[model samples]
Target chain A: MNAKDVPHQGSFRSSLYLFIILMIIWLVLTNSLKTEELLSGLIISLLLTHFLSANYRELGLPRLRLKRAANFIAYVFVLLSEIIKANFDVAYRVLHPKMPIRPGIIIIKTSLKQDIAKVILANSITLTPGTFTLDIKDDALLIHWINVKSEEEGEAAKRISERFEKYLKVVFE
Target chain B: MKKGVSIILLLILLWGVVAALSEMPFGKAKLEVAGHYTDYGKEDTGAANIVTSVVLGYRGFDTLGEVTVLFLACIGLAVVLSTLKKQGCGARQTPSLILNTGFRFLFPLILLFGTYVFMHGHLSPGGGFQGGAVIASGFVLMYLSVPKIKRLNHFVSTLFESVGGLIFLVIGLIGLKLGSQYFLNNFLPNGEFNTLLSAGIIPVIYIAIGFKVGSELSKIIDVLLEESE
Candidate 1:
């Protein structure tokens, strides 16, 4: 989805999609199938969907196919493992008497266009021990790395964002 | 000199806190009122959470006063901020793709969580005030992440706030009309324990409180954010 593709007003199809999603959330939240709960949920969901659909038109929620959704779930596990690995790496660096650490900020560009995907990539990088997102400017992110492995921007971006961005592109785009 | 005074003040406060802490016994229920509430709260209010029963059922008038205080604070903030000269659009950078996407994804989930908290007030640890704060935090996140997004309509939020307060008042009046005599009395049937529909008017009042508090706090955030802009 691009800026141009964003609807000025909510379309009927999008509104219906929002309604269904909200209704499912309401059902899960209430955790009940009683008539009153269902009735209230229906009314609330409809009202909320109507209001939010208009406001959220610019958001351009991705259309998720089952396979993509599964891929996204798999991506979460991968991100988790990476986080664990990063934790161990940080612990090792901290514990070592030599304290093998060379910290510096590096500018990296992300190819991921979707705000959500870019955020996920940035957060993933930050969560992993070596790197932290300091500031975001357009397509570039200034990241503080505990051990600056590479100085070259492209090489650094590839190393930091490539793993997550590849999957995020599939999930979001 | 200021630093020295602050340090001395901090030490004095710390000493006072320690002295107060040393007098209280640990791991013991001391308050007779607390015991009374715990033992009889569920039976009295039909709420599984005794704290919720006390806040919304027993001392509901106090909660109303607290809500009024919050409302006043928000009103005061709006009044103060409204007088400020509007700043020209500052050189705000467009947020990265990641922040925008992440906020949108989390927004609905946060809303759902907040609604769940307030809805289950009678049955669980959470309640209207907590849920409303959570919802307001979600709005704060929206402001931080997506600065250019259309603002929440003031008219709609004001309507919601007023309607919520009016509902709470109407419910209290109904309690009075039903011959309970006290405001916010449990007039409706206190259904079976632990059910969503149980707890008489507690849940209804809590929901009203939730909407009112949520809108009021969100408006406060809006005012503050706009002032900064």
Candidate 2:
């Protein structure tokens, strides 16, 4: 998703994208289809989208494609499964009297270029049972591990980020 | 020793304040007005949300005063904090990549939510003050996330704060001229029951107050951030 490829300046497309997102949020929140609510929402969202005239310059809305959307959906499912599995791991550890744990902070590098993708990846890591995202330095993430399986950066990145990164790379890159 | 003395002072002050406030007949002094507002507030103010009616309908002048107080506090903070900074602000560690990148996407959504909250103040649980605080929180989020984020244009922030106040004042003046000879009267037709355009000037005043408070709070955050840096 190269932002530069998209015509960003004074583009109605950006406004339209923002409008759709805001309208969805508005409808979901208000849960009303009355003409008054719709009309007011339309006016309000439209006016707010006018701020796009300023610097939402790098609005990183993903390019919509069937394959990419499918990838994103897959990514969400993968994330949910990972979180649930991690939750059970946590539960198992907590229920056990003698806690089986090795905790350490490991720095893992990512191939991902976009900050948004990196953030999502970090969030996914944090949500999972053992690994907590402590910080991000450029493309590298400092993750605190409940069990330090691999001291090596490459192995750790593979163990932690690789599963999510493949789907994200295809979707985001 | 100093901490103990301060605690004693705080306790004495709290006791004195609580003793004075205990005799005020809490929440019962305005029964007739409260009854009138509760029973007929909907029809009278055309706001289904009774709190909205009481706030923007009956106590609008007070809301104006509150917003002014906030604006003054922002100005006071800026002046006081700017002097506290030693020379140019010192450099700090840049925020993580996740935060720096995350803010751009989240900033607009938060702003929209705040707008929604304030815009729907008439029909919803939230009002201008809450929504404005929410909007200001969005800026605070951005500040924490983006270390390289440029300073807010003081000119623009001040303009918005003043314009919002002016709108609130002008609407009151308009109310006085056209409707009842009272300040901040609901002069305009309250469109329909429980609709967006209903509540007469409540939504208008609330939106202005939202802008005023949001800008003022954002400015305060900017000043505080600068001082810390």
Candidate 3:
């Protein structure tokens, strides 16, 4: 659904929040406190925030609380370590004389209600060694796995997405 | 027979590359103009990046012509794509939760990055063209992932594109009126070197260029996406 169709509240406050954030980014990027720079930045930031916050409020954009934000950061760290482990696994498999790979596309279901969380789950799965997300149809993800460890879809989905989905749900949902 | 022809063509390309490489030795200074630009570019243009001075200062008219060519290309793309039978919006499938969420999260970050790139064009490797392309890519990602959202507003994009072009032209005209009777001449005070506010008219022109290019490209993408909808 288009954001314009949705009803929302406190748009002005949200716009102010966006303006302040954008101004800080502008300050950092420009690395200047000159009158002209500040003036232009204020004007541009206000315009952008006004336009953007309207859509944001309409969309019912998720509020990123401090606790969730911190959890998201921690989640990133965990994903990175998992990626590194996957890389090592791929390398070991490639270096082995006997290429032991049973590549197959498996259909796996995700319970993630938010689009962002589902995307994160897919990306994390793809980043992790030996699994690549090929497509997303409804609640199911089509994944290409280097080795099909299980024939059961439930078992495969659990093994692949369960680790990341828990944190994603908390961060996004 | 086809294989032999392909091999012969490859060898010819290889020979040409080798010959060109031999003419210009690796890891050696060449091009007398390069030395001149590096030595006096800062003093003359007051821009820290000699490359920016060269592109937007030394041969600004040429850059303007290039921008016109790009504008024409976008116009041509629109003309060509308009004739195609447009797809109904209903044909599009809803994107997965993951793609939709990821796109929303990254869209603002990409816009911020693009702005940073164009703003620092005078001081860094990036410029209007690169930044504009980045912004367009962000739009493309949005179009791909979130098909249900309303398309990019055509009126706003076209307005920004025209406004940017107008600003560039006005600046050039002002340069002719105030500075050396040349178009795009530095009219305002070239502020202190290596500063954000430095390089009179260069940053302004680049910002104009960034907006123009960003809008034009995003418009082209919007058309293409809609045509396939």
Candidate 4:
């Protein structure tokens, strides 16, 4: 049933739900159920509800398709490994006497469609080593790379986006 | 039928399910991951209260962002209220003797309690965000009881928010410069465990956060009240 049809579906109900959820969170975090903890949780939940009620439409996100989700997880693992390698590489380059930083921005196209997925992809790009996602435009992410070893920037973008964006579209969109 | 409505419903359902799942035995892994700040506190930062460490130190950037959100909200409220003429501004009646007397009695004690929470955040489970809200509640009580009195000053509130935000940013920048990774601990000493002076930069940061939050919230309440009027 649509939420509007349900009784107590307004801000009051939402606040109550938020309070319970926050209380649960507080419990988990502190592993305590003291009066102070409950009071604190209620206060936090009240604040959250007040702030988030306007944006309740974005509250819950759906699960990805299993195969696609698995692929995404695998992609993340690969991405993390790549990021660690890149961090070390960057650290080495920075510490090296050569100091090899040829910083420049590059634009790369992505295949993800959903806005949420696109945002996740963009953030992922930034979270990884060396490259920062500066701007996203027309299905393309403008990235600032600390160092560009290869002349073919498009190759790097395509390779990186294709690795995750394809799976992301299946999972998130 | 609207895509937006459907999306909202889906999200609510997602949250409901996640909240339920998080209560299960397997939830520890999820909590460990989700509570990234707690992870830092437990593993590297050595702070007893994971939430305090997270709010005050690790992932402090997020806390800073949260405070900025409060500031923006206050500013937005102020803009909205400035255009409206104040009507029904004063208390309709002298607050009942009980409420006025109770508030007068409780406000100072509550304020002190809130301060205590912020000061001892590292050793215990309270911090700036929690303590700040408590202080704001005290102001709210005063506002409720003595409506004619301007409980908090807007300019002062804004000043606190800006200064608090700037201090948080400066700390981040200092961390970057010190070569101990961004938002590194031990920039100040961890201090004695149970004392108000303990937990390195934590109490200092919490105090800043408390001021920032208290001001922002009071401003929000003032604007919201004006709008209601």
Q: Which ten residues in a row have the lowest lDDT in candidate 2 chain A?
A: A1-10
Quote the positional error of residue A103 for candidate 1 in Å: 1.7
Clashing pairs in 1: A115-B97, A115-B101, A116-B101, A116-B102, A118-B98, A119-B98
- Where model 1 places Cα greater than 4 Å from the true spot, the runs are A1-44, A54-62, A135-139, B1-26, B85-91, B146-150
**Better model by lDDT, 3 or 4?**
3
CA error at residue B219 for candidate 2, angstroms: 0.6
Interface RMSD of each: 3.1, 2.2, 3.4, 18.7
lDDT string for model 1 (B1-229, tens) is 9999999999999999999999989999758988889999989999999999999888999988888888898889988877778879786877655566666666765776787789889998998898898888888888887786688788988998888888888998898889769778889899988988999999998888888888899999898888777
- Per-prediction TM-score, please? 0.84, 0.85, 0.82, 0.49
Which residue segments of model 3 deviate by more than 4 Å?
A: A1-46, A54-66, A107-111, A135-139, B1-27, B81-90, B148-150, B226-229
The superposed Cα distance between candidate 1 and the true structure at residue B59, in angstroms, equals: 1.0
TM-score result, candidate 1: 0.84
lDDT of 3 by residue, A68-110 (tens): 8887998899899889988988888898999888899999988
Error of 2 at A83 (Å): 1.9
DockQ of 4: 0.01
* Candidate 4 lDDT over residue span B1-229, tens digit each: 6999999999999999999988878624556555666555554455677776666666666877787888788788788678777676553755543354345444544665666566557778788788888888887887787666655776787798889878767776777777687654447766545444556766777778887887788778867865664
Top TM-score prediction, candidate number: 2
lDDT of 3 by residue, B1-229 (tens): 9999999999999999999989887777856988898998998888888899999899888888878887888889999987887555557776655566566555665776687778778888888888888888888888888776687888888888888888888998998998589898888788988877888888998888888888888988887767666
Q: lDDT rank, highest first?
A: 2, 1, 3, 4
Best lDDT goes to which candidate? 2
Q: On residues A1-173, what C-alpha lDDT tens digit does candidate 1 reach at each position?
A: 34445555436655776678778888887888988778877877777776666534555557758877887998899899989988999999999999999999999998877555666778888888889997666678889999999999989988888888888888877
Model 2: lDDT equals 0.83
The per-residue C-alpha lDDT of model 1 at residue A51 equals 61
Root-mean-square deviation (CA) per prediction: 3.7, 3.8, 4.0, 24.0
